[model samples]
Target chain A: MSGVRLLVGTRKGAFVLTSDGKRQDWMVEGPLFGGWEVFHVKASPADPKRIFASLSKGWFGQVIQRSDDGGKNWEPIGNEFAYGAGPGNHLWYDGSERPFEFTRIWQFHPSREDPDVVLAGAEDAAIFRSEDGGRNWDELTSLRASTGSGWQPGAGGLCLHTILSNPADPAQLRIAISAAGVFGSEDSGKNWKPMNRGLSSEYIPDPDAEIGHCVHRIANHPERPEVLFMQKHWDVMRSDDGGANWREISGNLPSDFGFAIGVHAHEPETVYVVPITSDSEHFPPEGRLRVYRSRTGGNEWEPLTSGLPQENCYVNVLRGAMSLDDLDPCGVYFGTTAGQVYASADDGDSWTEIVRDLPAVLSVEVQTLS
Target chain B: MIRVRLPEQLRTLAGVGKEVGVEVAGEITLRGVIDAIEASYPMLRGTIRDPATGRRRPFIRFFVAEQDYSNLGPDDPLPTALSGGREVLMVVGAIAGG
Candidate 1:
């Protein structure tokens, strides 16, 4: 029987929700690492049974947990993450130079063909690759050689949050860092170059600089990897030639400052974004939680509000808090800062709460099993 | 044999009880007890202290009896009571909450 598993990473622990493709009834099992914070939990596409989770705490530093039999059991792997090229200096919030330090893993991207090969993005902004099933990791230091001195932290610290791997070209890769803009690697993460050409940020001294854009999220469909959608600090951007050039696509939406963005599996041009009120206030506009969809790839957008909260709701959707499954009709899932995980089994027309009262979800990932 | 008390989180990570017993060879010192603990539980190698600098983490503290041994050097000899296992060495997390 076909099934789906949703791995939820929260402020307190990790939860695993499973259902048989009907997407209605779900079995929730959770609080795995009881008191620790789970930043992300993701399954390997090549081997669905292999899963990786980024677990950490303010008192305990960081811990990486790996599950061989799906999410049934997990074993703690290596937790050591040291910057490769001796700690370099970057602009601090006060405009003073501060040395880069490794704090925690923010995101994990496993190789599509090899389960043992995975990539980890870390805070203080660096990338590490693990070839031996995450037992060890080596930093790809060459990426910093491109432009490391000028990178600064956004409000959330300098974190390498979003990593996108191309399905057609194995060597092509893209990663986004807050306050540093987007960077692309054509040689499988060995070398990188800033890809923030047409992006403009008013907060920085230079509005159209090469870097420092503070991109919250970036997503692209596997079928058409060249086209990308992004939720920037204040603008919804769309790139045509894979980040070489970007243009604003925040048309008709109530607000453009959001953190989560995703593309539909069946329809590549169909995209989704939750419009937060503004940069200072992270809640929805007018206390109404809505998911705006665009069918024309960029400009024209429509609010999908059949089953969403219409009034007296103020919740924030984080960057890694939303995901989509590749099943027929395509299920859309998102968790909120207010501890609610909602799902729309039929594209974004309506929704149902999968499970509530989870500790402030940090990330939600979906695995579609055939 | 020396008795050591770990913080709640470290105890949970190491899968131990209220306290653990360790065999310390040579003079009893802050460094000796930690080496023995890491040798016994490999998973706790980098939790209490950093492996790169060989220094205690800013948030982790070591206490012997009622006095704080956190500021003492790693090689400094600890209280003699610890040598006979009469007193317990406590590994504590600083009073910092998230």
Candidate 2:
């Protein structure tokens, strides 16, 4: 049966949930890398059978696993992420500078055209690409060494957590690094330029600096990649000019502090964000779990809380936890830190808890199978 | 043939038995056994040791007949029993992570 596959990464391992078009009943299959931390698991849009996963353990390091037949079996591929040493320094907590070091892979984006081509966004803010599937990797060194020297780590390590590929222009890509703002490359990651103009961060000494803005997450509808929306550490922003400039759009909703922001599948103007109380308070506003939708792109908003918890709920949705499936009515899915997966089949009108217990959900991606 | 035992996780990942044997023709040492194991099962590379530096991962220890050879040099001679194929060399994953 043609269905949807939710590739879920968790603090412990990876899980694959399958459901038919109805989106009601789901068959769960996994804890694949059993006790390891599966950072991210995603299927390539070009070929749904090709799935890539990043699994890491602080003691055992990291491993990149690829599955040729969906999630049935996996093989460990290249996890050797070597960094090039150069004259670059990052801002320490005390405002001092430190040399850059390679950490873990935060996001793995496979090519939309070729299944063998993939991109790995790493901690310490760098990009690596593999042309022959995941067998070999070479550092896309220009992204960091050139314009990202002054990058600083947000509470999490300074990591390239988001990679957005423009659907209109195949050669263009945009990556978001914590505390470093946004950067884009026109020629397929050979070179990169800061695309963080008009964005401001109050935490940094210079609110108007070119870099050091803590961008939590950025989202865009596949139909129109130019109209982008971002959830920064302090403000919700929108960019109409392919990210060249951004303006605050944290209009009438509740708190602007959030991590996950996503656009609807069909409606380019509609977006969804779950507002947390603040950085220190990571829970939802008034302990009420609500997903605020901006149908006009930004400024005006309405909370979708019919099937969500209205009281005594204190789960924080992460940056990579929310995703939208391109179905007829559009299925929106989000996982919580408290080990719950919620699915809304009716375009944010209501939701249902799909799964009750699992490890804390880390990242979620949907593959609409034909 | 030098008999080597992998940890539970590594065993499942490498699709091997609890203990697998690798052919080492010359004087057997930690380095020789590791090279033979990685050559035999290429997927096991970079898991127990760093692919670049070849240093044993801090959490993985080596022992043969109750002797911990983890601190010894890579090319250090294997224990008499281990080299003679009488005792199995065990790759241990430390009891870390709560």
Candidate 3:
């Protein structure tokens, strides 16, 4: 049977939601690791049964949980995330040098070919790869070596929040840090180069600096890995040349300052984003929740509000809270700060609240199973 | 055998009850008891203290016979009550969160 599994990471715990292709009914099993904050939960593409979750708390630090039999059972793996190559310094918010520290894993990117191989993007801005599943991790030090001192923390505390792997070529990768801009690697994360050529940020003194831009999120279709869509701190941007250059695409959004951007599973040019009011005001514009869709790539978007809230809805969609499933109609799902998981079975035409009041959702990911 | 107590969260993580008993091989010092606890339950390694710095986590406190030993050196000998198994070493998570 073809079904979909939604791995939702929440402020308190992680939930696994499953439903058949109809996407009408759901089975919610949840609160795994209750009282702990689950940053991200994702499954390996090669094996649907294999799943990984990033669990952390203020008192316990970080713990990586893995499940080989889907989400029914889990075991704690290595939580030791030490910075590689001396754990150097980066610019703090006040323009002072601060030593890089490993806080928690913000997101996990499992290998498309091997379930045992995975990559973790951690706070304090660094990337760690674990080849032996989640038991061991090694930081890809070259990422920090490429002008890390110039990097500074956004309001989100200098975290490497996104990791995008090229489906066409696994060796080619791209990662985005909160205030460090984007970087690309050709030789499998061993070396990296800043890919923020055309990005301009008014917040910085130099509008077009090489390595400082608060990029909220980045998305791309698997077939079209060279083209990228980004939701920046204040603008919606697009790149057509593997992130070598980018241009503003915030054509007609009510507000271009928001998080959570995703691409359609089948349509290479179709994209989705939830625009909040602004960076300071993290809520839907005008108290109406809408997922903006762009059918012709960028610069043109339409609000999808069939089954969404239209009045007094003040929830914020985080950067990692949106995902897409590879079904025929292309299922789009997203979580919000108000603890709601909304799913659109037929692209972004209509939506449904699968579950609500499950703590503040940090991340939402879906796996299309056969 | 030395009895040790962990916080509710650590006890849940270690899959144990309120108190756990472990046989310390060497001198029943604070460090040896912690080492024995970690050896018996590998999942609780980095929770109570940092692995790199070997210092107690800011929110984690250590007590024996109702005396704060968090500031004591790791190698310092705990109270004789712990060595005789009369008092369990209490590992507490400070009351900080609202």
RMSD of each: 1.5, 2.0, 1.1
Q: Is candidate 1 or candidate 2 better by DockQ?
A: 2
**Ranking of models by DockQ:** 3, 2, 1
> For model 1, how does the per-residue alpha-carbon lDDT over B16-87 read when each residue is reduced to its tens digit?
997999999888888899999989987677777766567788888888889999988999899989876799
TM-score for the A-chain in each candidate structure: 0.98, 0.97, 0.99
Fnat of each prediction, in sequence: 0.15, 0.41, 0.41
> Which is better, 1 or 3, measured by TM-score?
3
Candidate lDDT scores, in order, read: 0.89, 0.87, 0.91
Give candidate 2 regions above 4 Å deviation. A85-99
Query: What CAPRI-style quality would you assign to candidate 3?
Result: medium
Best candidate per TM-score, number?
A: 3
Interface RMSD of each: 1.6, 1.5, 1.0
lDDT of 3 by residue, A120-210 (tens): 9999899999999989899999999888888999889899999998987999999999988999999999999999988988877886789
Candidate 1 vs candidate 3: which has greater lDDT? 3
- Least lDDT summed over 10 consecutive residues: which range in candidate 3 chain B? B46-55
Which tens-of-lDDT digit does each residue in A1-370 have in candidate 2? 6689998989988888889988988988887898888878989888899999998876567788999998887888888887764446777777789877656788988988999999999887889999988888888888887766677788988989999988778678888998888998999988888888889877767756788889999988877988889999989999998899999999997999999999999999999999999999999999999999988999999999988999999998999999999897889999988888888888889999888688988899999999
